[model samples]
Target: MELLNLPGNIIETVVRMLVNQRKTEEIKIRRLNFVQCLEDVLNLRATCVRLLEIVNNTRLKFPCVVNFSWKDPELNFDLHCFINFMANDTNWRFETVRFRKTLFHVEETNSGLLSIMQKNASLFAKSVARLNFDLPLGSNSIVLNVLNLLDWLRRESLKAGGQISFCIKDPFFSNWEAVLLVDHLSIRGSLRRQFDIFIHLVGSQKFPNLSQLDLPDIIFPVAKLCLFRNLHALSICNLELPENEHIPLHSTQITALLLSYAELESDEVECFSNVLCQCFPRLVYLSFKNTYRTTFSDDDNLCLPETCTTVETYSHMLFYFKKCQSIRYFNLQDYYPALDRKIFVKQLLTTLGTRTALMSVRFCGKELTRTDFMSAVENIVEECHSLDVLSVDCCLLDTQDSLNDQTEIDLSKIVRGEKILPIDGQESEAMLKLKDLCRDKQLKLLIMGKTVLYKSTADVRLMGEINKLEDLYKWNLKRGCVQWLSLEN
Candidate 1:
């Protein structure tokens, strides 16, 4: 009855049967725990010679989705696992196969994953796209040694007419690799020393292809904006940028800028306005919340009105936004709770006047009009010529009228050129207004978070929009997915 002593074929047969059994509804919940089943397989792989052979025969089959973690130094990936991954069937899911680790194993053998990746460099270089690394500070020294492998993969990927999305989820400037090897880097955590290194790398054009830079922890110095030459998207959440200084950027490739929880000082509004006008001419998507350089209260009700008082602050922000004529989407996420809807409507017209290039307006979990929001819709159609998409989190808007407000949306209908009509007594005034706008603008509407919950799964709607099914499949399959989208219509 010792499983490890069994022959390779026998082990494979048993494992297959067990996997099948665990998948069944009869056994999924009560019969076998998931962790225990995985543990059983891991033990089998480590202790049994047979199971490794079985892995070899199967062409080293790997799931399209990969999520590997290193909890401790003892965990290892042997030669078998590395060889298995090199199987010609290596296609990965574009949903960011994450490799995260905290502790660095210093026994000179190198961490199991690094060893495997190094050993199988040629095989891995040809496969991966969209690599996201979220390693802790302690792993910096170990990661430094593997810089050559990363650089090789990056260089090879570019030569194949493909770009590697190397994401670094921390601020660790151990050397120049922090900026040199990353496409998407989030400057965060214990960044006192790392900050200076980051400035040096960026200021010196270390990573010419770095497209996205996110800073949630540091109140970054305003002068650093000029450092990024190829940045396409920048996100700075909850930090206050100094006002009275007109910071300029060197990159026209910049597209999306998200500062959801940013605090705007009174004097800083004009400075931002100037930057919006002068620095970002090709800006496409912009998101910001109105917070006058102060923190909100713990009480929900008390926090909102204080932020909404800054009507003039938002007006200037909108005025500056006029220079960003190429913008396609705008998002305002719960920054204003109570405001005179008339002023908001007028300001919308004034700022967005005749700039019809916008495609979507997403009010994510924000409070909109309670009564007649349709007033803005008429102006949007007349002025903003190409507006088609309007997504709002209508759950927050409260009205005394017994209008049946929508709770969920069907993405199937939205993509199919069909209209989503409101249910009887369920249609709020805002919904009715949006319906009119959709009719006039010929728009596609979605209730936020309802349509395509994860951005990775957003291909569901686009699949229907594509001219042929085969083409869609061929396209997504390259990224390691097969039938991830439900097509059982």
Candidate 2:
């Protein structure tokens, strides 16, 4: 083969080929690094595509986490290309794919990206098992994008026999177009058809292998309760009944239910209580925050049949407490600040007392005196004998003096499980006695105060005493305190 002398151009061509190969290698390396930088910025989808492209071109095996960010134009383009390539390529096999914390923001009302997603829906449904569908708070266009993506995913999963865990953050922010999209899929004529779609997706045997469903801050109508069977966890926010409507008890197989901003009429509390007790019998964790108006009949002094049951008064919460006895963890937010603290505490104690399985309690509210707070703690400690964790952020002891500076308020010693001496002549002994009780119980006390004087261990005995001193000096040095605090646990 080397009999004839090679031409000068032929030699140059071989040299040029070698140089171009090196340049291609360098380019691939640079592109890979760039994709990694994007991943560091939480741009996973782009990184995946870029890596995939490099791998396909060079036959190189690269292992990296794929994160998707909707904000980057190049990243979005790369993602769309990657999806198209994956759909066409049969050799690519992903060990794991995660779509975590990617907030979608569509610039226009119509989402062209959704059509691309729908076109390659099977590849995405097969590759991705964990997906987080978080959209910007007010982006109506993103909702349509989500609905289209979800609908495509649902259809694809049904055909492929694959399961997906989907999380929707703030579903109520969706615009009319998104709502209509859900309605169209649900085949239900009502505007509130998304709930039906969600239930249908959850309950359908066609997609029986679906594992996790997270719906944050979404209110479900009464008809949608049956769709939650076999779910591992369900988080609902702003749970409310339509006016003049009542939901009966229906059992679900969900393990966890986070109920926030439960808007129910006073008369409807009993019905709500019954529904909770009967429906979510297997629920292990239950969380609730805030309340709505209660409907009370004036003439008969009873609940209207169309409204919630007549258990709307504060006394009715006890009924809920009794019904939710099987729940292991309860996080409650007090709705009524003006109600008698002693009476409320007593009712709570009586209701939760029967639940020996209770393990944790989180209480948040205002207008709770130190005594009132202690009473509630004691009630939980006594009733939920198995309780391991207790978090309380309730305001203790109302002060009449309106000091312009909140720093002038003497709260340091009081919060550090220290005995608060009466600044005035009234009830000094009671304060001292309460301190002794807190110390005896080994309660972790967190007090927000202006000045906190360091005390020796010999002075007081408590499990954890965290005093957040709000004075100027403390505020300046607060960073150090925060660092120390972070290191403590």
lDDT of each: 0.43, 0.39
TM-score of 1: 0.53
Error of 1 at 465 (Å): 12
Q: Stretches of candidate 2 above 4 Å error?
A: 1-131, 136-207, 214-229, 237-251, 261-278, 288-290, 293-319, 322-328, 343-351, 354-389, 395-489
- Which prediction has the highest lDDT against the true structure? 1
Alpha carbon deviation, residue 363, candidate 1 (Å): 5.4
Which stretches of model 1 miss by more than 4 angstroms? 1-97, 102-111, 114-125, 148-170, 177-179, 192-194, 201-211, 237-255, 293-328, 334-386, 393-424, 427-489
lDDT (C-alpha) at residue 220 in model 1: 58
lDDT of 2 by residue, 25-81 (tens): 233131222233223222222345543333333311121122356435665566555
**Where is model 2 poorest over a 10-residue stretch in terms of lDDT?**
478-487
Residue-wise lDDT of candidate 1 within 1-489, one digit each (tens)?
486676767777765544333223122122222333343345555665656556434322121222333323234333244345444433211212244443334543255545655554545544454455455553556566446445554554223434444334554465555346567776566665577876786777788878888776666565566778688877776434444454433334566666645565444555555455445556644555554433222221111111111111232235334444444443332223343333335545555544433222322113333233234344554455554333333333233221233233333332333445332222344444444554544333322323321123234554343212122111111111111222111
